[model samples]
Target: MKGPLFYSKILLFGEYGIIKDSKGLSIPYSFYNGALKNDGNASEAALNSNQSLKRFASYLKDIDQDLVRFDIDKLTDDVNAGMYFDSSIPQGYGVGSSGALVAAIYDQYAFDKITVLENLTREKLLKLKQIFSAMESFFHGKSSGLDPLNSYLSIPILINSKDNIEATGIPAQQSDGKGAVFLIDSGIIGETAPMVSLFMENMKQEGFRNMLKNQFIKHTDACVDDFLKGDIKSLFKNTKQLSKIVLNHFKPMIPQQFHELWKKGIDTNAYYLKLCGSGGGGYILGFTEDFEKAKKALSAHKLEVVYNF
Candidate 1:
């Protein structure tokens, strides 16, 4: 059976901020998508996915009955029916690969789950977040459930604060603008669990907390505001600072080899690069007003344009 597709997600802003009740924004990325399909090629990927879903079903069953609920029988039936996730989104790159999968499963198998047609009010949204949190914990060890929620809903999700989220709109991508926003694949996979654990450990240090509050989150919050206000110039300026801050303070999250390339953008003023997801090795988002100059500066790497004006 063919099921609705779910796309990957990009957390445009509020990576670590939303956890602290900072304003956040996330948008669906359609370039990479996945859907549930009945297929005979139960190869390694399919088998692995099947095992994962099975484990997730068990986790759901094991959860506190009052806190989360789902129809396990139906999910089991679908799994037995050769349901496999056929997807292009890369796994472990921090770009919602597993998030899309989790969303698709929830959309299809939850008997009493909220439907897309139903009014997804704030109450329902919060409930879904709770359910999805328990459901997705099978994959992430710990989860905020925001990624799958964003993918399942396939809309721009704005986090006004930690307890609040709603669908929102972004300024339409400019058609005639000279600047471009794009993705630069790091050509390596990144595991979320370890990266998150590292972040948690770093949180214990007073110095790290200070950097996050005074510098990293400050510039990040500015980038989000400037972007939403359509202040392209300021957005890029803050993004450069954010990129540099990440490069210096978040060195562990960045792959070692790309350090020079990361600094080159700041030193040359051609482009500013930042993490797309948690940033161990996934796709890095790049901002460049002059595409040609950014391209020339980083000609050695592959670049994919998400939007151009």
Candidate 2:
């Protein structure tokens, strides 16, 4: 049986900053998605996906009962029948690949599930986030749950803070606008856990903590506000500062090959690069006033435009 599709997500802003209660904006990326389906062949990807689902089902059963309940037996039976997640969302790209998988499983197997059709109050939204956080933590040792929440709802979400979040609407994309936001393929897979670990380790230092508050989060929060308010000029200004802070303080998370590339954006204003997820690799996010100029600047790399200003 095939389940309803779950789309991937992009944390347009608030990557690492969200961990420290910074505001974040995430949107559903329909360009890639996934769904649960009966495996018809023993393809390597399908086989591995089926096996992973088994482990995830077991882990769900072990989660605190108060948070959520699933039809574990039925889930098990489906896996036994060779049901696997068939997806095109690239893993480790910071685009919420596993998040879509988690959303699909919850939609199919979770009992007393929250329906997107219902009027989503703040309380209900937070509850869903809590459940998803617990469910997704199985993959990442720790999780905010926002990724799966965005994927599950298939809508934009605005994180006001750790305890305050709500559905949001972003400025409409301009069809012929020259300014744009894009994703640069780093050509290397990034692991969230280790990058998170590195951030945590750096947090132990007072200097890093100061930089996070005075610089990183400051610019991150500003960027979110500017983007939502349809202030393109201001958004780029803040993003430039944010890019510089990340390059200076969060070096480990960035792949060495792209350090020059990241700086070049800030220096030339062709595009400002930021960590799409945890940086180490995967996709490096770019914001540019002129897509054509940015394209020319990074001609050697693969680029996919996500939004136009």
C-alpha RMSD of each candidate structure in angstroms: 1.5, 0.7
Residues 260-299 of candidate 2: C-alpha lDDT, one tens digit per residue: 9999999999999999987788888999999999999999
How many clashing residue pairs, candidate 1? 1
Show model 2 residue runs off by greater than 4 Å: none
lDDT of each: 0.84, 0.92
Q: Which stretches of candidate 1 lie over 4 Å from their true place?
A: none
Q: Least lDDT summed over 10 consecutive residues: which range in candidate 1?
A: 15-24
Distance (Å) between predicted and true CA of 38, model 2?
0.5
Pairs with backbone N, CA or C atoms under 3 Å apart (clashes), candidate 2: none
TM-score leader: 2
- Rate residue 236 of model 1 by lDDT: 86
